[model samples]
Target: MDAAVNTPVVVDSNDDGTVTQELELEKMGSTLEEAIVETCSMPLENRPRLPRITLSKRNRAVVKALSRMLIIFLEASRDLCETDLILFGTAMAVCRIIGAKFSTAGRTTAQSSAIPAWGIIIEERIATKMDGGGR
Candidate 1:
């Protein structure tokens, strides 16, 4: 899904005496979108500044894919710490993406390269969403 499928169930008491569980898709999407915005926009003192040659053409698409994946993972998760684990786990993927996007002819080792592309990944991720393409 292009948008996040998470927001979980909301328990609300009606003006009457009935209680209900509401699956508010819009609310969930907006809330998750906000969370994503907050997470991505937080400033890092040591954030890397990738050169123009190192940027990905698919920055927006890749970030959309990754965010959707994260939402799916978050929605399916049971334990809270799993969320933490899943979030932290993307570090490897980000490095791999950086390596692949800016590959040198034959001298690049993403595993050992010190490119510091911690994002453009994150920047591109949130940047595109808030730009013209995102909902």
Candidate 2:
């Protein structure tokens, strides 16, 4: 999308009683809804599937932090692209990795490996999306 084409106009009154017109430049890109739909329509094998585990206090904290970071990034940026989606997925993968490491601290190596495995799957899916050559 052309950023210049989608610039927003703003009008302001000066102290001298004169009006000024300004162009607020913004990045032009797809909407969040469109991005979500594109993400959801990905093949099952190319999607992240985090296991259903009870959220511990630490896990909850990590989730909250990651969510806030994602919201901030989304709000501050104008364009939403596949790379952004991949970054978001990577953040989610990191959260899973942290949860898996903490939750499995006392478990067997095999059991503790589950979360990391899921994280790897999610990373692979993101990589596939990145290289699949489509938006």
lDDT of 2 by residue, 70-109 (tens): 5544575556564466454534343333433223123243
Per-residue lDDT, model 1, residue 30, is: 46
Q: RMSD (Cα, Å) of candidate 2? A: 20.2
Q: Which residue runs of candidate 2 sit more than 4 Å off their true CA positions?
A: 1-45, 76-91, 99-135
Leading candidate by TM-score: 2
Candidate 1 per-residue C-alpha lDDT over 40-123 given as tens digits, one digit per residue, 9 for 90 to 100: 443332223322323333333333344654677578667865565445334323333333332214334365364458855776
Which segments of candidate 1 are over 4 A away from where they belong?
Answer: 1-57, 100-135
Worst 10 residues of 1 by lDDT: 1-10
